[model samples]
Target: MFKEQVLGLMDQAELQIEGKRKEIDRIVDRNQWKVIRAFQKHKVSDYHFAGSTGYGYNDRGREVLDLVYADIFGAETALVRPHFVSGTHTIGTALFGVLRPGDELLMITGRPYDTLHKVIGKPGDGLGSLQDFGIRYGEVALLDDGSPDYESIARCISSSTRVIGIQRSRGYSWRPSFTVAQIAEMVRFVKEIKPDVIVFVDNCYGEFTELTEPTEAGVDLMAGSLIKNPGGGLAATGGYIVGKAKYVELASYRLTAPGIGGEVGAMLGTTRSIYQGLFLAPHLVGQAVKGSVFAASVFERLGFVTHPRWDDPRTDLIQAIRFSGPEHLIAFVQGIQQAAAVDSHVVPEPWDMPGYEHPVIMAAGTFIQGGSLELSADAPIREPYIAYMQGGLTYSHCKMGVLTAIQNMIDRGLLHLEDN
Candidate 1:
C-alpha cells in the first residue's frame, strides 16, 4: 500500500517536476557555463580534506570555498572554518554563534544527536552540555516515529529563547527527520512566539534533499561539513555555516582564526571539482538513492532486521544494517571492506577514541566516512548494528561496491543470499 502511494506521488510529482525542469532547460546550452558539461563528464577533483594535505593557508583556497558556499546555500554567506572537527563541533559553533550566556535555546527536537547530549547538559556532563555556559536549554520530543512534536516544541519556546537548533539531516542514526515544510513550520512557530528567535539547522545530508535550502523557507542559520554536501563529495576537509549575514559574521569569528574572511579567505580548491560535484549531484544523488533501495529490499528478504527504507526514506543516502553483537559489528564492516576495497582488505575493530568516549569501531574504505563513495562501515562498540556508508562518485562504482559487500557476506554464509 505504501509503495502504491509513493508510486502515485511520484507519478503526479513527475508532471510538476517536468514543468519546473523546463524552466531551467536553458541552463545547459553549452555556451551557458562549462560546469554543466564538466559535471556530466564526472571530472570532479578527488575530494581530499585539507587536514590530510597539512591544511594549506592559500588565500584563493578560501575564495573557492566561498563561491561554492554561495552556490550551494543560495545565500551570500561567509561560510568558513578550518579546525571544525566533526558535526557536533560545527553545531557547537552555531549554538555559540547565536546564543550566548544567559540566553535560552530550544533544541527544536527533544533528543538531539546523542553526542550533543553533554553539550546541552542532558546527561550531566557538566562542562559539555548547555549548563556549562549559563544558557538555559529546553527540549521538545520527536513524535513516536521521530518526526517533530510541534505543539510540545512550541510550548518550550519563551522570550528568553535566542535560537532554535534543528538537525535537518540524518547522520548515523535511525530517526526519521523533519521535512522541508516541517522545518519551515518550526520557523513559523518560533516567529509566532517571538519575532526575534533565530532558527539554526544542522544541514548535513540535507543540502540536496530538496532542490533549494532551509534559507528559502525561513531558516536563519545552516551548518554542515564541506565533505558531506557542498564540497561536491570531493572536499578533502572542513565544514560550512550559511544564513543571515550577521549570524554568519558571529559564527565566522568563532570558527576561524582572526582576519580569515568567512570561507572567502579559508578554502582553496579545484574550481573544477566543486563545480563538477554540484553539476552531477542531482543525477548522482538519484542513483545513490537507487542503490539504497536495492540494499533495503535485498536485506529485508534475508530476514536480518533490515532498515533500507525502500518505501520511505527519512533523508538522503546512507543505508544501515542491524547486526546483534559487537563481533557481528566487526564482521559486517570487514565483509563490506573486502567486498568494496579498491586495494587491500580494510579491517574494522571496535575501539573507543578521543572526543567521544563511547567505543566506536569503524572501517573507513573511503578517504573519510563522510560518504566518500568508497566502502565503509562503523558501529558503536557495544551494539552490533553497523552503518554501511558508501557513495560512488559515479553510479557504477557505487553499484559494484554494494553488490560486492552483500555478495561477500552471502558467500560466507553470513547473510542469506537470495533475499533481494
Candidate 2:
C-alpha cells in the first residue's frame, strides 16, 4: 500500500506533467498514422501473419514485413527477423557486416552499452571480436554537457575511419539522450569530414519516440531489439536492421551466411506477433514516455537528481534517478520488481551479470524475458548510484511501479518524504 504523502506526491506530479503528456500524445498521433500508412501501402493482411517453414525460402510474409519496416523507418531496406538474439547482437552484426579487418569503427558518443565491450574485444585476444578480426575501435567522449565533441571527433578521423557510430540513447549514463535533430547534425558533421564515411546509429530504446528515426536523418544503418520500443510489448523476440540497401544486405549476410543472407530463416510462428507489435508500437511507446515524465517529476520533487528532468525533451524511454548510495539504489530496483505483474514474489539482487564489468541489479518481471518495454528497472552496483528505469505497456502500470518503488524504499527507511 502507498503512503498518503506518496499518493499526494504522485497526484501533484501527474498534474504538473499534463502539458508534457499532451505533447507526447501528439507525437504518438503522428507516429501511429505513419505506421498505419506504411502497413496499408504494403497491404498487410492475415496472410502476412502466417508462419513459414524450413529455409523460409520465398517467404512472402517475411519479405513484406521487411518492406513495412523499411517504409516506416525511411530506409532503403530493412531486415526484420527473429534470428537476432538481442540489441547488442543486432548492433554487432551491423558493425561486423560492413567493417573490414583494417577499418576503424569510431564511437562519437563516449561509450556504448555495457554488453558491447566484449564485442569490441581486445587486440590479439583471439576471442573473435571486432579487434580480434583486426577491425580497430575508437571513441570520442561527449562534451561536459553530454553533447558531441565535434572538435574531438574531427581530430579522431583518419584514413582508416570507415564508420561513425552514434548511440541515440544514454545507455547506463546520466547524460541526456540525443534528439533526431542532434543525430542529423552529427550525420552531416561526420559526412562533411569524410564524404564516404558511413554513419551508423545504435537506436535501442529510441524507436517510435520521435516522429522521425535516425535512418531518416541520413544514418547509413541502425539496429534495435524487437522487445524494446518497436515490439509494442507483444513481440516474443527479434531485432531489426534498417538503412542503405547495401549496408542492410551486408548485415543480413552476417546475420545468416554470405550467400544465404535474409533469404532464409523460418518465422517459427513469430510473424503475427511481430506485425501486430509494430502496429501497436506508437501508442505503447507514448505511454512509456509519459511514465518517464511522471517518474522524473516525482523523484525531482523528492529532492533527488534526475536526468532529462520532467520538463526536458525526451528521445528515449529511460528515466534515470540518482540515489545517494547502493542501499537506496538496490531498494528502489527491488521495489520496482515488487510491482511486476509477473514474478512479483521474487526479490532481485546485485550479481555479476555476463557482459558487464560490475555487479548489476535488475528488476525485469515481464511476460517476455528481459523485456524492457514492460515496466523494468536496473542499475550497476557502483558509486554515484543511479537506477535506469524504462518501459511500461501502459502509463498507469508505470505510475504504480514508481509508487511501489517509493513505498518499498520508505518501508526500508531509505527514503523519507519529509526530506523533500
Candidate 3:
C-alpha cells in the first residue's frame, strides 16, 4: 500500500489539476478525430497492414501509410519507415538530404538535443559531420526566458543559409518546448527575412500534443521517432519525416539511395504496428500529458521546482523536476524504475551513454526498448540535478510511477512530506 501522505498528495494534486485534465481531453478529442479522418480518407484496411518482402516495391500499405501521415500533418508528403534507427538518424537524414557543401545550417533554437552535437560535428573533426562536409553551421541561442532570439536570428541569416532548424522539444534542458503557434511565428519571421530558406523542426517528443503540428505551422520539414508520441507505445521501431514533397524526397534519397528513395525499403512486418500506432497516438499522448501535469502538481506541492508548472500550457510530454542534488535525483529515477511493469527489478545507474556528453541515468522499463511513450524518467548526472519524466500508456500507471518516486525519496530520508 502507498503511504497515507503520498496518497494524500496525489489526491490533492488530482483535485488541483482537474481543469488541466479537461483541457487535455479536449485536445485529445480533436486530434483523435483528425487521425481517424486521415485513416478513413485513405481507406485504411487490414490489407494495408500486410507485410512485404525484399525490394518491397509498390507496397500498397506503405504507399497508403505515407498518404495518411501527409494528410494528418498537413504536409505535401511523408516518409515513415521502420528502417529509421532513431530520431537522431531521421533528423540527420533530412539534414544531409538537403544541405550541400557550400550551404549553411542555422539553428534558431539554443543547443539542440545532446545527440545532435556530434551530428553537427567539429570542423575538420574527420567524423564526416555537416561541418566536415564543408557545410557551415551557426546558432542563435534562446533568450533567458527560453524564447527565440529574433534579433540574433535576423542578424545570423546570410546568403549561404539553407536550412533554419528548430527543436520543438527541450531535450535535457530546463526550457519550455516551443508551441505550434510559436513555431508558426518563427516560420513567418524567417520567411520575411529570407523567403527561400527552408524551416526545419526536430519534432521529437512534441507530436500530437496540440491540435496542429509544426508541418501545419509552415515547417518545411519535420522528423520524429515512432517510439515516441507517434508510436503510441506499439511501433517496434521507426521514424517519420513530413513536409514539402521536395524536401521529403531529398531526405528519402539520404535514407536510401539517390534513385531509390522511399520506394525500395521493406516494412518487414512493422506495417500494422506503425499504422495502428498513429491511429492511437493522440489518445495515448493525452494520457502521457495528463501524467506530466500530475507530476508537476505533486512535485510543486513538495516545494520542488517543476518546469511548465502543473497549469502551464504543454507543448510536449516531458516534465522536468529540479532536485537539490544527485541523491534526490537518483532516488526519484530509481522510484520510477521500481514502479515499472517491466524490468522493475533493475536498478538504473549513471553511465556514459552514447550520443551524450555526460553520464546519464535512465528508468526505461518499457515493452519496446527506449519507448518513451511508456512511463519513463531519465536525467544527466550533473549539477542542478533534474530528472525528466515522460510518457505513460495510461494515467494510472503514470500516477503510480510519480507516487512511487516520491515515496522512494521519503523512504531514503531524502524527502519529507509534512502537513500542507
Candidate 4:
C-alpha cells in the first residue's frame, strides 16, 4: 500500500529521477576509487588495525589513520581523534591554537553555524571564548542572491586578520552550501589579498559528498565531526583536523598541550572503527547523497519548495524542504523520529537547545547520539518553516523515512497529496 501511494505520488516522474540516480551512482564509483587509492598509497596493513590503550604514542593504527586522512585531503598532516567532543570543539581548538590576542577572525561566508557563536563570543564576556581573549570577529554577509560578496571580503582584510573562515556546509541556513570549486576560488582570492592569513574551513556535513574537498582547494586548515559524513555511521564519537603541517601541529597542541600534541591520545578500542568507517565512508556518503536527491525530487513533486532541486549538483548531503507552516515542519520531524532505529518511542518538541538562537526541534534518533550520518531531521522554530533533513546509512532506509514523513504530514492534515 505504501509503495502504491509512493508511486501514485511520483506520477510518471520515475524515469527522470532514475536518470539522476544513475549519475549519482557514477559519482559513487569515482569517489570509491579515490578512497581506495588513498588507502593503497598509505600502505594500510594488518599492523595498522591494532588499537592503542594508554598514552597512545607511536601507535601504528593511529599513525596510518592520520596518513590516510592527510593523503585523502591532500594535506601535510591530519589529527583524527575520538577524544574531541564535537565538530564545534574541534573548530574551537583550531581557532584558538592559531589566532592570538588582538588578532582578527573574519568569516567570509556570512554568519556561521549557531554553535560557533559562543566560541566567537561577545567581546569581554566569556573567559574561554576568543572574543574574551581579545580576538576580534567580523563577517561579510552574502549578497541578496546568496553569493559571497567578494568586494566586502577584500575590504574586510587587514593587517590584523589571522584567519579567514569558511563554512563549507550550510548549517541551519537556507542558502545552498558552497561547492569545492567555489571554496577553492575563495581560497585563491583570500590568499591573494593576505598571503599570510590562514584559511580555515568548517567541513562538517560536506566530507566525501563530492569528488573533491576544501583542503584540496588550498584551504590551510579544515575540521569535521566523526558523527557526520566521514564516520560512515560507524564511528561512535570523534572529530578530525587536517591541513598544512604547521597548522595541524598547532591544532594538535591545542587538542592536547603545547609539547604533547597528537602523540599521547589513546584510541580506546576505536582505532578499528575509525579506520573501517573511513573505508566505508565513500559508499555510505553516496548512499546518503542518493537519498537526498530522492527526497528533493519527491518533495518537489508534492508542491513543496526544495533546495538544489533533483538534478542539481550536490556538494553536501543535506536536503532542505520548505513547509507551509510550523505544523508541517513538526509533523515531518516527528515522522522521521518514528522511523528511527533508536529512541523511536519518544517524541521531540521545540526546546531551547544549547548553542542555538531559537527553540529547535530535532529528531536525532541515531545510535551514536546526535549522529547526523544516520537518518535525522531538525529545524529551528523560525521563518519559512524549513526542515533540514540529512543522512541515511542505506538508501532504502532514507526512502522509507522520507515516505513516512510525507505520510505523517498527510495524516495530520498538514499536507494533502491529492490537492497538490
Candidate 5:
C-alpha cells in the first residue's frame, strides 16, 4: 500500500485548493489578455552546454536566466544559471548567500539530502562546510518512521539564527510528505519564534504539488530547477532562487561576483526557453501528475511497495518503487528503457558519481536522472534496497515505460498470465 495518512484531511485540502483555483480563475478572467500578452513576451533561452554561454564570449548568461526565473517562480527577485547544476548546488548557493561571519543556519529537516551532508558539514570540498562558513549549524529532527517534529525545531531556534531551511517534500528520504498547509504551519511556527530568520525551501519536485508555492506559504527563499516541473520538460537547462529583494541581491552576488550585485551580465539566448517553459508549465505539470498517478497504480498492482498511489500524492509528480537488490535495480532500469524509448534509442545503465555519499546508478536516457523526458526509471545501487524513481511528460509515455518492463518479464516466460 502507498502509505499516506492525511487522507482524513483530503476533503478540507480539496476545498482550499478549489477556492484558490477559483480565485486565480477570477483574476485571469478579468485580465486574460494582459496575462496572455505577458506570457507572449517570454522568449525561450537557447544553450548548447558545450562552452561559455556557448557563445564564444566571456558573457554572463546567469543574469538573463534570473530575469526569466523571477517571472517563473513569482518572486520579487530571482537568478538562473547553468552553473547551478543540480538542485543541491542551487541550495548551497542560497544558504551561503545569506549566512554572514557570525550567524548560524538551523536546518529544520533532520538528515538533509544525502549528497548535501558534506556540502553543509565540515570535511566537505570547500574550506568550511555550512558550519565553517561562519554559520554554525544544527538539525531539527524527525520522529521514528519519518515525520516532522516541529517542537524540536522550536527548541533549536536561537538568537544567532540567520536562516532556517525547510525541505518541503520527501526527496530521497523514507519520510512522508507535507502539504503546503502543513508547510505554512511550519513557516508560521518559525516566524513566530524568530521573525527575521530566513525561511528557505528546497522546492525541488514540489512546485505545484499543492496549489500554491512556498512564497505564498511565507518562505523567504525557494529553489528548484528548469529540468523539473516548472520547466515543462522543455527547458534545456538551469535552476532558480526567488524571494525577498535584498537577500536575492545577496544570493545573486554569491552566484557570480561573490559580494557585488544581481545584474552581473547575461546569457546570450536564455530568455526564450525559460519563457516558453514557464508559459507551458501549468498544463504540463498536470499532465505529469496524471502520469505519476498511473505509475503508482500500475506498480502497486505488482505487489511492490509504492510511496504514492493513483490518488495519493506527497510531493509533485514523482513515482517511487522499491525493488530487492542491485541486480534487480539494473535489470529494472534496462527493462523500463527497453520499453520506453522510441525504438529503444537510449539504453539504461548503472553508474556512480563523485560528491554523492553513496554509490548512485541511474537510467541514463534521462537528460538528468531526476529530469528527463524519456520514460527513465532508476533505483539506487545499494544492497537490499533499490527504490525505482520515475516521472514522465505524458500518461502514454509513463504507461509504455511500465508496461514494457512488465512485457519484458512476460516475454521471457518469467511469469504466466494465469498467475494473476
Candidate 6:
C-alpha cells in the first residue's frame, strides 16, 4: 500500500516538473562548464594537497582553492576559511570589518535571515552589536508586490551610509529570492545614488543557482556558508567571502586580526575536501534545485500555496509551502524528518532556538552537522505557518523525501490522497 500510494504521487510530481527539466539541464551544463574552466584556469595540480593538522601558511592547495573561487565568482580576491563559523558569522565579520563608528549601513531588502537580526541589533538592545558600535542602520521593506521600494531607499540613504547590504536569498521570508539580474539592477541603482557606497550581498543558499554571481553583477563583496550551496554536501565546516580586494582584505583582518589578514588561517587537513566540494557544487546545486521544483509542484498540486511555483524561474534552492495551521505545519516538518537518512526515527518539535524570535522546528539529518547541502527542512513557528525546505544531494533522494512527506501527511490525516 505504501509503495503504491507514494509511487503514484511521485509519478504525478514527475509529470508536473517535466516542463522544467530542459531549463534545469541547461543551467546545470553551463554551471558545470564554469567549474571546469575555473579548475583549468587555476591549473589545479597535485601539489595543492592538504597536510595533516594543516598548520602552515604555505598550503598551495588552500591558495589555489581561493584563486579558483575568486576566478569562478569574478572577484578580485577570495577568503575561504573554516574558522569563520556560520554564514551569519561571516556576514557579521564583513560588516564590522568595513564599517566604522558613525558610518551608516542601509539594508534595502526586508529583514534578512533570522540569525542576522541580533547582529544588526536594536536600539539600546544588543551589546557590542552594530548599533552598539555607533554604526547606524536603516531598512526599507519590500513593496507589497515583493519589489524593492526605491523611493524608500532614497529617503533612507544618509551621507553616513557607507554600505548597501543585499541578501540574495529570501531567507525565512515568503518573498522570492532575487536573481543575478535583479541584484545587478540594484547595484546600478545604489551606485547612482552614491557611487562609492559599498554593496555587499549575503549569498547564503543562492550560490551557483545561476550562471553568474552577485560579484560579477557589481556587488562589492559577498559571504556564504560552506554548509550551504557551495559546499557540495562534502565540506565539514567553513565560510567564504569573495569580492573586491580591499573589502575582502578588511574582512580577513576582522576574521583574524590586523596585519594577519588572509595569510595565516590553516585549512586543517580539509583543503582537499573544500576543493572537491567546490568542484562538485555546480552539479549538486542543480540537483537540489530540481528537488525544490519537484517539492513546489507536489505541494501546489495538493492545494498548498507555494513560493516560486514549479514553473517559476528559480534563483535559490528553497521551496516554501504554507500549511493550514500549526498542526499541518508540524506534520510537514516531521514528515521531512522521517524522510531523512540520519535520525529517521527521531521526531522534531518547535523549541526556543537561539537567534530566532520564535520556536523553530528543523529536520536536519545530514552527515555533516547543519549542512544545508544535504537534505533538510526547517520552519520558524509563526503565522502563515510556512516551512522552508531546501537541499538534497541527489534528485532521487529529494523525490523520495517528497513522497515520504506526502505519505506522512496522509497518515496524519492532514492530507487525504484519495480526496485529492
**Judged by lDDT against the true structure, how good is candidate 4?**
0.89
lDDT of 5 at 148: 68
The digit string of per-residue lDDT tens for model 2 on 59-128 reads 8899999999999999999999998899999999999999999999999999999999999999999899
Ranking by lDDT: 3, 2, 4, 6, 5, 1
- Candidate 3: segments with Cα more than 4 A from true spot: none
lDDT of 3 by residue, 80-155 (tens): 9999999999999999999999899999998989999999998899999999999999999999999999999999
Q: Candidate 5: list runs displaced more than 4 Å.
A: 1-72, 123-128, 340-347, 367-370, 410-420
Clashes of 6: 0
In TM-score terms, candidate 5 sits at: 0.80
Steric collisions counted per model: 19, 0, 0, 0, 12, 0
Which scores higher on TM-score, 2 or 6? Answer: 2
**lDDT on C-alpha atoms for all candidate structures:** 0.59, 0.95, 0.95, 0.89, 0.63, 0.88
lDDT of 4 by residue, 292-405 (tens): 988888888888899878888888989999987899999999999988888889899999999999999999889899999899999998997999999999988888788888
Worst window of 10 by summed lDDT in candidate 3: 411-420
Instruction: Looking at model 1, report the run of 10 residues with the lowest lDDT sum.
Output: 23-32
Residue-wise C-alpha lDDT for candidate 6, range 1-420, written one tens digit per residue: 355866876788898788797788888899889988999998998778655344457777878888999998999999998887898999999999899989998999987888998998966665789988888998889999888999999888889999999998888888999999999999999899999999999999999899899999999999999999888888899999999999999999999889988777677778778888888999999999999999998888888899989999999999999988998888888888888888899999999998999999999888899898788999998998999999999998888788888888888877886777
lDDT winner, 2 or 4: 2
lDDT for 364 (candidate 4)? 86
Candidate 1, superposed: residue stretches over 4 Å from native = 1-68, 81-83, 121-130, 257-283, 324-329, 342-344, 368-374, 381-390, 418-420
Candidate 1 TM-score to native? 0.76
Give per-model TM-scores: 0.76, 0.99, 0.99, 0.97, 0.80, 0.97
Put down candidate 5 lDDT per residue, 1-420, tens digits, no spaces.
111322222333334344333443343343333324444455423442222433324443344445545554557777766556777788888888888867878878676777677767763347567766656778888888566688788888899988887886666665666677777888898899999889988887776545567776688898887787767676777777898788877777778776545544445455466555655665555555555555566555555677765555445656766665565556566667775444366665555666665666665455544574335555666655655555566656665665655555555555333454
Instruction: Provide the global lDDT of candidate 3 against the true structure.
Output: 0.95
- The candidate, 1 or 6, that scores higher on TM-score is 6
User: Which pairs in model 3 have colliding backbones?
Assistant: none
